[model samples]
Target: MSETIAFIGLGNMGTPIAKNLIASGYTVKLYNRSPEKVKGLVALGGHSASTIGEAVKSADIVITMLSDDHAVNAVSEEILPALKRGSIHLSMSTIKADTSKQLAEKHEARGAVYLASPVMGRPPAAEARQLFILLSGDAAAKEKVKPVLSAISQRTFDFGDAPYTSHTVKLMMNFMIFTIVELLSEVMLMAEKSGIDKNILLDTMLNTIYGAPVVKIYGPLIIKEEDNPNGFGTQLANKDLRLAQETASEVGAQLPLAEVVRTHFEAIIAAGGGKKDLPMLVSYLREQSEEVVK
Candidate 1:
């Protein structure tokens, strides 16, 4: 589409997504809070911008993959002023729906297009360009960036034209994943304490009706007590869960299980498992059980 992209936020997921865009022959201007990450991308033929305004000024498409709502808000200060009219501001962060709606309104008022394009996949999937993207925003702007999205995602699913819809979908998807992880931890621990083989049970469930990506991908990690080396830490998971809980409450929907899962993640973070992977929820359950027994 002959677009220049300003890629912001060079964390695990952003790093590879930006790499994929560079690989796709897009002229990318890279910006990060950390210079080391920008240097790494520069080595791969990306242009480094000294400031967010510099990155957003000459870009046709500005993409933000920040960590949270606050990070996105801070970046917007630099981007909104320097962003060219008619440019597309694509947000790929897992942020709150209200945050996205606010951004969309501000972008529209500024004559820019804002899109919510939250993704579903871990860092490995992003690195491999196999992440599933959920998109919602101005239809014309979406079409303009379709090729760019294709370059970095396995598939892009449209959720109509409401910018917040994509964020809602992403949060719900995350809630389901976290709930499953919580349930799996409980079941796997119970099986272990009852003298049942976790590996055999997980294998059986994985090959049966419960053979979904969530179980198959995370089951082994929990069983082997492996940490999440790529995806996300418990703290981030808890944040997403809290977003989901807030979203559900806003819509007047009940999510009792999400509330329970949120507490589990909160406890995990309080116990200093915040930086550990999501699979460590299983380990946390095991430790708590051991403490009770003691």
Candidate 2:
């Protein structure tokens, strides 16, 4: 608990993660562009900083949990100039693998280290410290951040020395989640139209086939259509999907189904569901299936 930590980007997930760090007896400096967010954490034994540089400058480790690539990149610029030698930038954002590689190179040039340690979980899971953390980068840097990782996650999967490997896995994980969302959406539509009882479909899914935790979680959400409060919003879901294809393009890989799922996301957004939770894709797909029958 001797190490000082700076947590930037106080979104849903970031807030709880930062609070857990403070609760774990680490000194936490909190920062957000909107001072209001900083205030909330400040009430919970966190120190507030008005700027990213001010938050991270003296800290032993700087953690970023921003929304996407642009936000992560903008903060990395400020972090590079202020981070001291041997310090760590624990980037927990769901960003591009290329961005992680680029950030690691820049940090190394400045005598600092970047660890692409993004996590998989919702805000509630973050609050419970049950996230599955993914880490990949320099051996020493990864070693240094072990305490911080332990404080925030139930398990850490080391993706090896290449920093980009972690992000690749993170994106692939999210892509798989979205594919489940897409599949659950379409299958639920068919089930409803075919008069398959909702409980029966869920029971069969959980018992017979496709019963991973991700499937177990979303199956009922799609059946009940419970996307309220936005566990995974459209903007971020679409951003991850887009990042998947962009990453695929970088290596000449194909993601045909991902491409189609993104189109459905676009159509949902265009129809004024931009702010809706991702499971709303079921409703979107249902409307389309109805049209085909007509």
Candidate 3:
């Protein structure tokens, strides 16, 4: 018989990951705070769960992909009492390392297993089942979930029994991504001020030594003044940056560039771009250009 899995938090990324699991022939019990979000999955023969507790009650595995530490904490508390003994809880959200470690211990005390398996990639990657997962937990627990993880991700990087390791790596990765966006915004602003066409500069950069897939993917949006239909919204990006900054502060690490990126995001949010796509930071950069000209 196939394993029964409970997938909670059916947001943009979670929805696709769950769809991939269902396509891969798993019995998935899907639950989302907004029940409407799970209607498509329900129509596809997946089970709709009314609550988190109801979702994992009979499942062999539980997976969560929520927004922040508070959301994860709330779901964990609500579901821990209902989870069957020995069932594994795979947390796929990018959260604070300390929070992940604490939750892992709490779940272990409840006779349940927990694994920090935050993934790297956006919605498109999730839809394609091409996410790269970073996992940290007991080897045996990791082994048990390997097949399910493989179904949704192209590769999984194991970081041993330190649950916080995976979360830390995820935050560091986001720091790099956000910093790149900041640099891209600054460079585009400079080019525009120099009478260079933004598209021309982008095309040249894409074909040169500075080119990579990230720029190739995000460059056009930055240049075209398009802001809607986000792959990842600015609010979430700002949240992740704040989490990274908090983690860095806890470890006495100096993340000067990340600090600047955080400030840029704060400016974006203050300017009412919070609901827009993250790449919309270019709009803020353009505003800065106008201010400089005046």
Most TM-score-accurate candidate: 1
The 0-to-1 C-alpha lDDT of every candidate, in the order given, reads: 0.90, 0.88, 0.87
Tens-place lDDT per residue, model 1, 169-259, is: 9999999999988989899999999999999999889888699998987888888887856668888888888888888899999899987
Candidates in descending lDDT order: 1, 2, 3
lDDT for model 1 comes to: 0.90
- In order of appearance, the predictions have TM-scores of 0.97, 0.96, 0.94
Q: How far is candidate 1 from the true structure (C-alpha RMSD, Å)?
A: 1.2
Tens-digit lDDT string for candidate 2 (195-279): 9897788888888887898887788888888776638888778889999999888899988989888999888888777778877
Q: Which stretches of candidate 2 lie above 4 Å from their native place?
A: none
TM-score of 2: 0.96
- How many steric overlaps are in each model, in order? 0, 0, 0
Which scores higher on TM-score, 1 or 2? 1
Better of 2 and 3 by TM-score: 2
Residues 54-108 of candidate 3 have per-residue lDDT tens digits of: 9999999999999999999999999899999999999999899889889988988
lDDT of 3: 0.87
TM-score of 1: 0.97
- Cα RMSD to native, each candidate? 1.2, 1.3, 1.6
